[model samples]
Target: MLHLRVVCPQGRTADVTGVLRDEPGVAHLVVHPGVAVHPAGDLVEADVARECADDLLGRLADLGIDHDGGITLEQLDTVLSDRADAAEEAAPGDGADAVVWDELINRTGEESRLSLSFLTFLTIACLLAAIGAVTDSPVTVVGAMVLGPEFGPMAAVAVGLVLRRRDLVTRGAVALAAGFPLAMLVTALATLLFDAAGWLTADALDALDQVDFIYEVGPFSLLVALLAGAAGMLSLTSAKSSVLVGVFISVTTVPAAAFASVAAIEGRWSEAGQSVLQLGVNVVGVVVAAALVLLLARSRSRRRGADRALSDG
Candidate 1:
């Protein structure tokens, strides 16, 4: 379930209340007239079933409440009331299967922002990957993938395409465009330092180990990328955070970038090109797969809603 706290102009309270009251998925409604000080409006609160959240939020948006006021949603980890159960039962679909687009968008928006902290994490992750690549350590490659912060922008792109939000698309693209190149440049510079320090020798760079896969983009890479993309999208929408960690560890974006950086520095132009191709394949595959999954989920949700409406009528 989700808890929604709304602040709306005094005149719109009736409209807001009516919308909430009419929805079978909403319960424990409370209204506090003229209670919102900063927004200078009435405060309304309710428990909403997740299955109905997207539609309910859309209705609220149609009222221009978002522009004139505010709405915030919080997940109710433990709702002890029978009322909450009733709300869930009254909703058309299963709560666990619901998209809860507002929550999804908000979460990804925060995650996808290109902040200094994000850049720092990306840089550090790429550096680790570069070291791992030069050493041909599969364990270190996996660690670098886990540490990378590239998934946020990938998810943002998916959500942007799903919602037709150009701002999100632009922001996501900008983040990727800036973040990857920055990570690559930093990794390259760090590789030079490692080479100068004699820690990364030509023999180490040419080691016949896991690093070979990083620079060998092939059909198998495409297949793996497609699978990872689907799983990543499922993890995000289903709130399966543990599964998301697995998804992060399974992708090759970080390793590919790092491998490309190190390979270029070592004058392995062909290997660098292949590594870049691997990165591009994974990124493109992920975005395309994620967008498709979201679209399909939303379509199913809408169909279920339509069926419920017909039955009710």
Candidate 2:
């Protein structure tokens, strides 16, 4: 369930309340009249079923509530009221399966931003993978995979493409374009420093065979990326963090970037090229698969909504 709070103008409170009262998926509706200071109208709140969130919001949008006031949504972990249960029962699908488009886009938009934390995490993950490549440490490589933050922006890119949100697509692409190269450059410089210290060298890399898969791009690589990407987007839309963690660990993108940087630092141009190719293949597979999954999910949602509307009429 979602908790929706609306700040309405003095003149439009009735229209906002009417929509809230009419939505079958709403429960525990509350209206505090003349309470809003900034918007200067009324404060209205409701508990809404997840399956009906988008439809309810759309109706409110049609009323121009979005422009005249503000709407805020929050997910409720537990709704103890019988009315809440009834509203959920009245909804068409499981709350866990519902995709609140606004929520999804907002979340991706924030995560896809080109921020300091993003660059820091990506660079650290890449450096860890580079260390793993030089020392042939599978555990470290796996750790790098789990730590990589590349999926968020790429997921945003896919979501933006499917939803036709140009801002999201551009921001996501710019983040990726700038983030990866910066991380790789940092990782390469770190690798060079380590090599100069005689801690790890090209010979150590030569002896490292366990992490070779990072540079090995094959059909299975794309297949795995496709599967992981689909699962990742599903996890995000469904609010399943456990499933998302598995998705993070399933791809070789971070490892490939790390290995490519380390290989170039050691003057192994051929392996670096192969690692670059592997990274590209994985990225393409993920974005394409994620977009396809979102497209299918949206289509299904529209059909289900149409059918429900017809039945309601």
Candidate 3:
């Protein structure tokens, strides 16, 4: 279930309440009139079934509540009310399978921003991967994968494409476009320093047979990317943050970036080309797969909504 706190203008409180009351998936509705001070209106609270929240929010938006006031949503970790259970039962599909498009779009939008923290994590992850590549350390590579923040923007771009949100798509793409090059550039410089310090030798780079997958683009690489993309979308829609950790570790995104940095630093142009290709293939595959997954999920949710509307009539 999701908890919604809405602020409504004085003139629109009754209409907002009406929308909540009419929604079968909404329960425990409360209205406190003349309580909102900033916008000067009423405060409304309700619990909504996760599966039906997107539609309910759309209805609220249609009522101009979003523009006239504000709507805030939070996922309830635990709901003890019988009414909450009834609301979930009243809605179509399992709560865990719900898309909650509004929530999804908002969450991904924030994650995809080109913020300082995002760049820091990306740069550190790339640097770690570069270290792993030159040292032939699988543990370091895995650690870098665990720390990489690339998936968020990719997922955001995919979801944005499905939702037709140009801002999200542009922000996500810009983050990726700018973030990767900056991270790689930093990693390349770091690699040069490591080489000068005698920590990373040409022999070490050439002898990394175990880490060769980092630079090799193959069919299995795309296959892994496809799986990662599907799993990533599922984790997002289902609100399973833990599942994303596995997705992060399984994909070849950071490793490719790391390999490219080292190869370029060592003047291995062919190997650098291959590594970049690997990075591009993985990113494109994940984006395409995630978009398809979100598209299908939204389509199914719409169809279910249509059927319910007909049955209600």
Q: Rank the models by TM-score, top first.
A: 2, 3, 1
What are the per-residue Cα lDDT tens digits for candidate 1 across 78-156?
Answer: 8998988998998887776788787788878888899999899988888888877777778888889999988889899
lDDT of 3 at 118: 95
- Global lDDT scores for all candidate models: 0.87, 0.90, 0.90
Order of candidate numbers by lDDT, starting with the best? 3, 2, 1
- lDDT string for model 3 (1-313, tens) is 8999999998888888888898888899999989999888999999999888888888889988888899999989999999988888987788888887888888899999999999999999999998888878889999999999999999999988998999999999999999999999999999889988889866677788878889888899999999999999999999998999999998898889878888887888889999999999999999999999998998899798899889889
- lDDT score, candidate 1, position 233: 80
> What value does the lDDT take at residue 143 in candidate 1?
89
**Lowest lDDT 10-residue stretch of candidate 2:** 200-209
The residue-by-residue lDDT of candidate 2 on 1-313, one tens digit each, is 8999998887888888898888788999999999999868899999999998988888888988888889999989888999999998987878888888888999999999999999999999999998887878899999999998999999999999999999999999999899999999999889878978888777777787798899988899999999999999998898786897888888999999988988998888989999999999988899999999999889988998899889879
Q: What's the distance in Å from true for residue 256, model 1?
A: 0.4
TM-score of each: 0.94, 0.97, 0.97
Model 3 segments more than 4 A misplaced: none
Error of 2 at 253 (Å): 1.0
